[model samples]
Target: VKSGAGYLPVDPSYPADRVEFMLADAAPVAAISWSGRELVLPAGLPVVDIDAVDVSEFDGSVVSDADRVAPLRSSNVAYVIYTSGSTGRPKGVQVPHTTVAKLFANTESVYGFDESDVWTMFHSYAFDFSVWELWGPLLYGGTLVVVDYVTSRSPEQFLELLAAERVTVLNQTPSAFYQLAEADRLASESGRAAELSLRWVVFGGEALELRRLSDWYGRRGDFAPTLVNMYGITETTVHVSHRVLDAALVADASASVVGQAISGLQVFVLDTRLAPVPVGVAGEMYVSGVQLARGYLGQAGLTSTRFVANPFNAGEVLYRTGDVASWNSAGDLEYLGRADDQVKIRGFRIEIGEIESAVLADVSVAQTAV
Candidate 1:
């Protein structure tokens, strides 16, 4: 029977027909529901019902009749995550299972995953960041504390969850972290703050301002969590480069750099010609290696353009991150701005060109530039 790392079904409240159709399209060998829903097998595929199955209940005796054979297929379709239909319609990004595993392994290598680390899964299940936040810890047998929507929306509850869960490794957007820091909630909960086991906190989905992160850490004491500023695009899974922020680096007046590429990945600041730009000169960043996704789902044209053959490596593909960045004297990477019109606002990456193309439909302005 076909299956994946886990048998997590989509939200039960969603249309069952749509969910079934989606599962059929994805062609999973088995299905599991969070609720105790009876399984009605699809026409040809064998199915396993994991309804109400807790982590402790792994006995195969329940589904003794189910086929236990492993299915063989290309690793190119582990996650078929649909993007928000902001431009026209939602399109799925088919990421390889191998890429997902590599990204998770890379994350663990960077943060040193351990049983002592308790991660709070913040992002929606649909978001790719959730892949790292959800599976990365579980991959290493670390504890995962799922954060509810209400707690994510409220600043007070956000801090309280960290303390209550004793979250060690947390990742969030700059805006959300800023909100939690700006609020005086942590001040009143001294006991809770003292209990915080936060070892590392990562910021991504937007350019993390060092001053803002420092200010937040300063509000607490030196014993507070170490902040990690990560940078990467979705096509590369989650993160490509990350820099750990310590009290000394935070106190430095100069802008902190994004640091070198993580192990197993190669990062290059290339010019329009795709040639490596000289040190200190700004150029578009390109990432190549196992962490890169196979391609965008059903958008071969778009995929072909962004995911191109690695200029240096004969058989490799590199994801062209249209971000203008440069290397500092210390060999750290520093982001300047977007090489294209795309901007990151409130954590969502918005392509200005796409917006402008849509606005051109309206006859309001004679000339426009996004």
Candidate 2:
């Protein structure tokens, strides 16, 4: 922010108790909300009513380095996004300016983003994916379209918005994109077609069913809106690896290939002993680099356990992502699934994702959950 203040975005739909809990946990200096929005506020907390402010009266000019009250540092905590705490409470991940900067450090080389691009704020700010979607346009000098809650839930409306705004960059979860693809298919078949200007459709949040994309390719092709699968977590600042999906990779129905690490990020698939496993062997994924978050807000114990000192990189810490994965022969990391998602039944290990994949393989099954 201009004043170097760290913000925590909570879902407006949260219940009174949940909202109050987050407010107490985060302990923000002030609470901001629109006038029309009725929020559950804590007593004695400062409130900033956005709708009441007359922005037209302000200078609206860019401030130079000399005009600032204080110099903004890269180490400053840019935001604190609360994630679903495994323990039942929400834990905040304090993302520093440097981490966010590193996320887009190689935008030109990795993504080729520029001023001409237009990105949509598709995911909620409570989710770490918003960090990428929100800062993407700002860091890359591109346009940002803020999608409302109603339209964001409707795939048909979202697709129409993409066409209307000429959005060049789109980000989505595999589940969300599936719905959009279906909407696109229906529109095309119904002769109510609206050609989109999207150049990239990035995927994250969950494992993608690459085989299901065959229908999408049949209609729009893969090269038009180059599909990319970026795998990552909140503590790692949105994304770790970037892989542009193509027909070749998508042929393998069960393969969830998340390619090489981003420029300033590092990843390793290791065994229980913290030693790197052999290629093609499943292991827990660990990540380290500038993109790593400061840690959970006021959660020292959690900070130490997950963000432990890296055995390989002395003096550095690696965030122990509970994700299970392995390196392919070609140097790409294939996401197996969550470590906990794998269950042992009758002395045999079973990955729920594998079962889900097999069920989804059936043409009659539109969607399946395992």
lDDT of 1 by residue, 1-370 (tens): 1343323335444446545645654566555543455445477765444554455756545433244335434473666765433353334566767777787667666677877789999977756668789877878788999998888898877877888888998888888888887654455455444356788888888776777656665666555677878887778878899887766666662654678788789999999888999888989999998888767666778788889999899989889888888998778898887886678886666666556656777888666676
Q: Between which residue pairs do clashes occur in model 1? A: 2-29
Q: Whole-model Cα lDDT per candidate? A: 0.72, 0.84
Tens-place lDDT per residue, model 2, 166-217, is: 9999999888899999999999999987789999999988887788888898
Candidate 1 lDDT: 0.72
Off by over 4 Å in 1: 1-70, 73-76, 84-90, 184-194, 221-223, 253-256, 353-370
Top TM-score hit:
2
Question: Who wins the lDDT comparison?
Answer: 2
